[model samples]
Target: MEVGFLGLGIMGKAMSMNLLKNGFKVTVWNRTLSKCNELVAHGASIGKTPAEVINKCKVTIAMLSDPAAALSVVLDKDGVLEQICGGKGYIDMSTVDPETSCKINEAITSKGGQFLEAPVSGSKQPAETGQLVILAAGDKALYEAAIPAFDILGKKSFFLGQVGNGAKMKLVVNMIMGSMMNAFSEGLTLADRSGLNPRDLLDVLDLGAIANPMFKGKGPAMLQNNYSPAFPLKHQQKDMRLALALGDENSVPMPVAAASNEAFKKARSMGLGDMDFSAVFETLKVLKHSS
Candidate 1:
């Protein structure tokens, strides 16, 4: 099937590259046209707008920054819904709340287009390597129909029932991730203040049951004070807040997630939003020194 990809940010570019590398016919569009240049050279077609993409492809995938951007592209004046028709498929890989996903699904289904939420679990490197885990939700037939494309973009894909479940799953996963990162930041700061080497602390953690791929992956970067944006702090904060909101709506108290949200809020308040989430370490460091 011909696929159109929208949004060419860090993860989006990597995912689009994977699709191209796997020999899928992909047409791409980005708000910043320059972001599509490299993909264009790699034999991916570039489109000027979402309408043009939907016009040319059977499946259109979006990996935008947030719900607002996703809504803008899918519901805008010349957006996807404007051009989508029966037999066309729209899969959103952006991390958004379930409510937003449901709204988008409604718009697409009303227009006779199939909709799926297939938010991913992984960062840029995983996306580039096709190691992303896709959490998909939509009509069963539609999920099956998109498997070929999903296989090219990810290592594994799960069909989790109807639209919105994928987004809900993403929020839950990110809530734990946000909390873990904050806890690790505090631990690292405590170790350093006790005159214990950060590297040694990382090594110890790696050997313990508390160790996870997140710490193993981010620990070195944190130790070296490299805050490059594998996942931006602001986005992580957004996900945590969304997760907290979900908890509130369901009447399920997520005290740890709530606390993590506050940490990310503080991090953003300190102008660390654009940095890698591991920059939460810097927040902990500042607090430690002040104390």
Candidate 2:
């Protein structure tokens, strides 16, 4: 099937590449058009504008960085709305607030396009291997229609009933992930400060109930202070902020998530925003305290 893809950031590029490798015809667009070169070399077409891609493909999927980018690509001049019409499907796989997903859904549906919000779980390695878990909602038909592509992009996909559900699920998942990372950082710092090897601590954690992919995947790299961007710190902080807002709207107190957001903010303040979210480890590591 022919597909249109937007936002060629880390996740976007990998996803679009997977489609190309799977023999799907994909037309892509990005704000910095030069980012399209890599995909073009892999046998993908380029669209001069978001509208152009939508006009040329029946299914257009976007994996933008944030809600603003997601909205701009669809609402700005020469955007998706200009070409979206009946029989066209638009799926936004960006991590955003439920409200943002709702806004995009309304706009697309108003223009006779099918809309789906499908934010994924997992980072760079998962994205590259198509092992991410997708949380999808809005337009069940569209979700079903996009399954073939989703199958290639993610190992699993869920249909969560409404437009905002997928976004909410994604935020909640990321919030918990941020909180866990914060706690994990504290453990590592405490272990090292107390003369215990952090590597030993990771091994212990890996043998226990909390053993999971994230800690195992990030622990060693973080120990070497490898802050390469997979899912960037700034984006994690943005998800935390958006998740906290969702909590506020529902009158729920998210103390852990709020604290995690603060840690992420501190890391960003240290110019670690472009680093991986695990770079928040630097914040805890650098804190001056007496034992």
Candidate 3:
């Protein structure tokens, strides 16, 4: 099937490449034109605008950076909504807030276009390997119709019943992930200050029931103090804020998540937002010194 893919950032680029490798005829666009050059080399067509992509393909998948960028491409003048027609499908794979996704859904469906929120759970590596888990929400018929495209992009796709649920699920997952990462940082720092080798502590943790992919993957980087961005701190902070808002709406107390959100905020204030979320370690270091 032919597909239009937009927003060729680190994760988005890997995802679009997977679609092309799976032999789908792919048309791609990015705000920065250079991001699409590699895909163009792999026989993917490049579009100059979101309208161009929607007009050219049956399905348009967006993996933009944030809710603002997603809305800019879909609701701006000559945006996807303007170009979408009946029977066309739009799948947004960005990690946006539920309210934003619902607004986009309303706009798409009102224009006679099918819409699905399919926010993903893995980062660039998983997207590169086509092993990302997709949390999808919208019409079941459209979910089934887009299954092939979903399969090409990810190992599994879950139909979560309505437009906003997928975005909600993403916020929930990221909230837990952010908190876990912060806890790991605190433990590692404590081990170091107590004269235990941090590496050994990581190895022991890896063997324990508390072990997780985040700990295993990010531990080595923490050991070496490398904070390159797989997932940026600002984005993690954004997700945490959204999750806390979700909790507030439901009258649920999320003390752990609230604390984690402050940790991320402190990290951002330290100018670590452009770095990996692991840079939360730096904030923990300052807190440790203060205490």
Q: Arrange candidates by TM-score, highest first: which order?
A: 2, 1, 3
- Per-prediction TM-score, please? 0.98, 0.98, 0.97
Candidate 3 off by > 4 Å: 288-291
What would the per-residue lDDT of candidate 3 be over residues 122-223, giving only the tens digit for each residue?
Answer: 987788998999999996777888899889778888999988999999999999999998898999989989999999988998999988788889899888
Clashes of each: 0, 0, 0
Least well predicted 10-residue stretch by lDDT in candidate 1? 280-289
lDDT of 1 by residue, 1-291 (tens): 678999999899999999998889899999999999999999999989999999999888999999999999999987998899898989999999999999999999999999999999998789989999999999777789889988988889999998889999999999999999988988887788889998898899999988789999999988888999988999999999899989989999898888888989998999999999888888787777798
Instruction: Assess each prediction's global lDDT (C-alpha) against the native.
Output: 0.91, 0.95, 0.91
TM-score: which is higher, 1 or 3? 1
lDDT of 2 at 84: 100
Pairs of colliding residues, candidate 3: none
Q: In candidate 3, what residue range of length 10 has the lowest lDDT sum?
A: 138-147
lDDT of predicted model 3 = 0.91
Q: Model 2 clash pairs?
A: none
Candidate 1, residue 70: the lDDT equals 92
